[model samples]
Structure formats: C-alpha cells, structure tokens
Target: MADMSVAAPRSRGLSLPRVNIRAVVMVLYLGFLLLPIYWLINMSLKTNSEILGTFSLWPQNLTFDNYRTILTDPAWYMGYVNSLIYVVMNTVISLTVALPAAYAFSRYRFMGDKHLFFWLLTNRMAPPAVFALPFFQLYSSIGLFDTHIAVALAHCLFNVPLAVWILEGFMRGVPKEIDETAYIDGYSFGRFFVKIFMPLIASGIGVAAFFNFMFSWVELLLSRTLTSVNAKPIAATMTRTVSASGLDWGVLAAAGVLTIVPGALVIWFVRNYIAKGFALGRV
Candidate 1:
C-alpha cells in the first residue's frame, strides 16, 4: 500500500499534457498559407519607402493613405463597380443558359449528344487567348466595346460551358422518376423545374455561380482588351500603378488587398453550398 501510493504520486508528477499533432500541423499549415496575405495587408498599411527599406512583419508607420486613395479616387473605385457589374451579369447569364441546357443534356437522348457535350467542353478547354483578338475585334465593330455587357458576354463563352457541365453532373445524379412523378401529378415542365428540380440542385447552382463569379472577376486579358475607360475592371485599373516613376508598390498592395475582399466575401457566403456541391456534383 505504501509503495503503491508512492508510485502513484511519482507518476502523477512525471505525466505530461496531451499534444494533438494534427491540430498543431493544421495550425502551422494555415499560418503558412495566410502568411503572404498578412504580409500584403501589412505592406498596404506602410509607405513605399518603408516597404522597400524594411523587412518587418508589421508596419512601423501605419497609414491608410493607400486605401484612402483607392476609395476616394473615381478611377480606382469605378473599376470595382465595373467589375461587379460584369461579373454579376455573367454569373446570372451563365446560370440561366446553363440550367436548361444542362437539364436537356441530363434528361434527353438524341443524335450527337455525346459529340455536342464534348464540343461544349472544348470551348472551356481552349485558351482564353485564342478568342481574345476575335472578341476584341468583334466587340469593337459592334459598338459594344468598352461596355460591361461586352465583358459579361465574353466571359459567358467560358462560364456557360462550365456551368452546364457542373449542373449536368448534379442533374444526372437526380433520378428521372422525380421528373416522371412531377408530370404525373399535373405539373408543367416549367413549374416542375422552377419549383421542384431547381431546389434539389441548389448547391450545384451556388457552386457554378461562385466559379463563374471568380473567373469573370479575375479575367484580366479579356477585360483589359475589351474595355478602355467607362467599363474598366479593377484588374485593368491595377495596371495603372506602373508609370514613369515606377510601380506604386503601396497603392498596388492596397489594390491587391481590396481585390481579395470580394472573392473572400463570396466564398464566405456560399462556402457551405460549395462543399456540398462538390460532394454531390460531378466536379
């Protein structure tokens, strides 16, 4: 009894707290991924001189002038508005066009169906550069140049195919019996699709919209090529930071930080849907 009590006290004193290896690794991995974003924000708040001269994790002389310039300047802020306009338009158009096309693809059987599906995918596979010149020329000739709709339409060339492909996958997973049953219960195709079918694949729609939004928002080549002034996107505006003096590093950093905000907010809003969409959709 005396020996047992002594050993228990000794063992208790020597014991160590449990360490979760996976949790530690995850934290370290996340920190590594976020380090650049943190540094960008850090640089945005510092002057160009400080950014170039110092190698600090945090800004020494913090200033909001960089952000203030972007927020206050019409040239800078309008870029954001223009980008939102086209990106939203593109997403809406892509989903609208893709829904019926995808449903047709998922539910029908016709000649060249496989070939047609492959053709749609080929458009997505083609490089954005391949169509850039053509789009530029076409839009310029049609008086659509430098317009938000021009960019939105150009983006649809890519986004619509991808949206169709993704939505088709989700639609395929859904049983045809549901469609039959809906028709049996005196429902029109439009009513059944709008009320019943669409809800079933809501996750897929969210995922498609998220991807379309991101692509349209970040597409520099087409947006820059097609637009000049009135409909210039923020991606195009960021290039103005380069001049005879050199790159405006602070303003550029601030712009980069601001650019990340919309995408991040979108991811936050549709995060759960994206997760489920991937799990259920063909992706």
Candidate 2:
C-alpha cells in the first residue's frame, strides 16, 4: 500500500508509448482515406477551364455551379429521387424477408438446414453479369421492366441473402434461455419475438439496412440494365455526360459528388447501430 502510488506513475508512463503509437497509426490511416475524398471535393469546386488548364492543387476560384446544376435540373435531381426510392424499397423488402428467414435459421435446426443457408449465401457470390440476360428476360415477360419496383425486386436477389446472413449472426448471438423463459411465461411466439428478440437484434437490422442501402445505391449494372430512360438511375445518367464531342467534366464531377449524399445520409442515421451491431459477447 505504501508503494502503490509510486508504482502507478511508472505503469501509466509505460502505457503512454503504446498510446502514442496507436495515435500515430490512426492519424496516418485517416489521412490516407481522407486524401482521395479531399481530391474529389477539390475537383468538384474547380471550373472546367481550371481542371483542364492547370495542375493546381487548389482551385483559384470556387464555384457552386456544379452543385447548382444538380439541384436545378429535373433530370439530375430526379435521378437522386429515383435512386432513393429503389434503395429504400430494396432495403425494406430485404430486411422484412430476411428477419423471418434468419429467425428460422437461428432458432431452429432441420434437415439440410446448413446446406440451405449456404445456398442462400451462394446467391450473393454469383456474378451479376451471369444473371443480367436472364433478369432482363424475366422482368420483361412479367411486364415489370422499366419500373422502380422491378429494380427494387431485382436488387433483393442479392440483398436478401446478405441481410439474412447478417441478421442470422446477430440472432445466433442471443441466448436461447431468453426464448425459453419467454415461452415458459406463456408468451406467444409472435409476442416474444416482437417484444424481446427484435429489441435485442435491432442493431443488426440497422446495420443490414445500411449495407443494403449502400450496395443498391452504388450498383450500376443491374440498375442500368433493368430500366430504360424513364426509370434510369443516376449512374446511367452519368454516361450521358460523355459523348463523341467531349466529356462535360464539370457536370460529371458535380453528378459524382451529388451521388455521395444518399450514402452519407444513410451512414449518419445508422452509425450508432453499426458500432453496437458489431460488438461481441452477446451469447
């Protein structure tokens, strides 16, 4: 006891070196990630003239015309709205279907269950190109092509499997005793799931939703192929900026910058859930 105070300072001093090294590593990694984002912002601010004329690190003039064009133009802004519609619809559909399927996988074990689970995940591993022609023909025959619902449903082919996998992991982390106790208390399965199981796995749902939104948001291949001009996505519109004449670098950069907003909004809303969802030791 007499020497405890004296030893405390020495122990703390030893930790300082490790802390400093961690801090340095974090700073370097953050800089590496932020550098490219900084470059995009810098390019977005610069005019077409400045972009082609000079290799300047910073623009001599900053203009809002790019952002302005995106906001003012119906074709541009509507692309964002169209993207949001499909992304939200896809996320909702995927999560709803995944929650029940994942519950089945986690709470019950049956014949060939593991094989079925792997098969679900295997859908995710399939190349989008392989499904492109079949998807187009399928959507066309059903008269669902060129509609937002078509793309939303198409995205579910991949997103549902992913959502199921993520939520199943989270559900597996919950103790079986909780379900047993709830059953013993005379709670119906529906009541128990809605009240107890759902709250426990809420974080996982948010995390899964974020992933669905991100994947569907940035995906070009399926979104572009499934829809014609009326339902075309922002990614499809970006192609129009380039032609035989030349690329409209300003509008294109502006469009690229604008595309990041929906993803950012999604992360901002679900960031808290993401951290908690990844935590260990629940089971």
Candidate 3:
C-alpha cells in the first residue's frame, strides 16, 4: 500500500520543477524595461495628428516622413556626424591616456599613489556645470570653440579618470609574473604591453572602450555647450526641432531612437568581454 502511494505521487512531483518562476520574473522585468523604448518607437512612426488624436499601444498609421526629414536635412544629418566625431575622439583620447596611467598604478608603488588615484577619481565626481564656464572660456581662447575637438577635450575631464579607474581594476587582476616573463624574454616595455599584456587584458580593454564610448555618446551638456554651428551635436540640434511652429514630436522621437542605435551596437559587440570582465572581477 505504501509503495503504491509513493508511486501515485511520483507523476505529480515530476511536473513541479518544470515551471521556472525566475525566468518568468526576468521576462516580466525585461518587458517592463523595454515598454518605454517600444512606446518611443511606436510614436516615431506615427503622425503628430495621430499621436494626439488617440491613446495608442502601437501606431495606427505607420509613416516614415520623420526619418525622411532628418535624413534629407544637412543641418539635421550633420548633428549626428558631429556627435559621432567627438564621441569617437573622446573615447580614443581617454583610452590612450588612461592605459599607461592605469598600468603604473596597478603594477608599481609610487609616492602618494593612493592619494593621486583618489584625486583623479574626484575629478569625475564634480558636476560638469561647475566647469562649464571655465571650459567655455578656455576653448574660446584656444580657437577650438564650435569644433569637434573642443567637445572631445572638454569631455576628457570626466572620461579620462573613469577609464583609468576601470583599467586599473582590470590590470590588477593580471598576475605580475607575466610582466616579468615578458621582460626576461627581451621584450621591451612598449612591445610587451602592446603584443602580450594588452591581449591578455583584451576583455578589460573592450569593457573600458565600451564604457568610454557610452559615456561620451550620451553626455550632452559639455558637448552642446562647447559646440555651435560647425560641430553641433545631435542633442543640441534636437532642441532646435522646436520653433515658433511648435514641436515635431515624431521627428524628435525618431532622433532619440537613432541615438540609441550606436550605443546598442557597442554593447552587443562587447557583451562577451563584459561577461568575462565580471568573471575576472574586473567590472
């Protein structure tokens, strides 16, 4: 009787673990997070009249006129080019400066290294507003105002320290013995770093590059403040979409959507490195 009772419940037990509550919760959370993006995309394809005429979970009448306007206008299209230029420039400059600094901090002990590292990071903590006037004055004096380099240099004030901090953490995870062995093999400092050490920490570099790109891409205040006609970023141009005629909500949403594409691509490309960084305790 007891054997029969146990066997009777075995089928019921078999189905209990099949439902993954964790996966369900994650899916719900992802959907919640994605709802705003979906709404924005929905709005971008809709006419201003349609948007105001009804509440919608999706566009009733899909249109591409908003994208057409942005693509055709030189002023509008140049905003994206200018933004991309500065963002790429800033990421390059930040990574170039941070790598050696990070290596020094990670591999060597120097006077007040801790104090210096802390001070560098403190630069990132200060609000950009505090330096906006100073930066404007400096760039104006140097004839870099209204140029892509101006925005890139201004952003460096923040991106450099962040890059250094992240790189330093990743560098510390690499064993010092590798450096010694490379040296013993007659590899010079620069050669060893480029050919060996850099590849060893490739994941860290990917993560750092991803971060630098993301920060510079999204940062508006410095980019907008430093640039004008010659090198105006998309964020600044988006504001001009508003005129005496009122706002172009569809075009604005479309611009916002386009801005997200580059960052998303960067994230997707570096996803493996990000995961590896986490595994190595570098993130």
Pairs that collide in candidate 1 are: none
Q: Positional deviation of 46 in candidate 2, in angstroms?
A: 1.7
lDDT of 2 by residue, 155-239 (tens): 9988998899889878887889999999999999999989989999887888888888888998889988999877888888788
Q: How accurate is candidate 2 locally (lDDT)?
A: 0.84
- What local distance difference test score does each model get? 0.89, 0.84, 0.86
Every model's TM-score:
0.89, 0.88, 0.90
What is the C-alpha lDDT profile of model 3 across 1-283, one tens digit per residue? 1133356444646656755876788999999999999989999999999888899888888999989988999988899999999989998999999999999999999999999999998988989999888999999998999999999888888889888988888899888999999999999999999999999877788788787788888888888788879999998899876663388889889988988888888888887566654443353
Each prediction's number of clashing residue pairs: 0, 0, 0
Cα error, candidate 3, residue 246 (Å): 1.2
| Cα distance off (Å), candidate 3, residue 261 | 0.8
Q: How much is the lDDT of residue 149 in candidate 2?
A: 92
lDDT value for model 3: 0.86
- The candidate that wins on lDDT is 1
**Candidates ranked by lDDT, best first?**
1, 3, 2
Q: Kindly give the stretch of ten consecutive residues in candidate 3 with the minimal lDDT sum.
A: 1-10
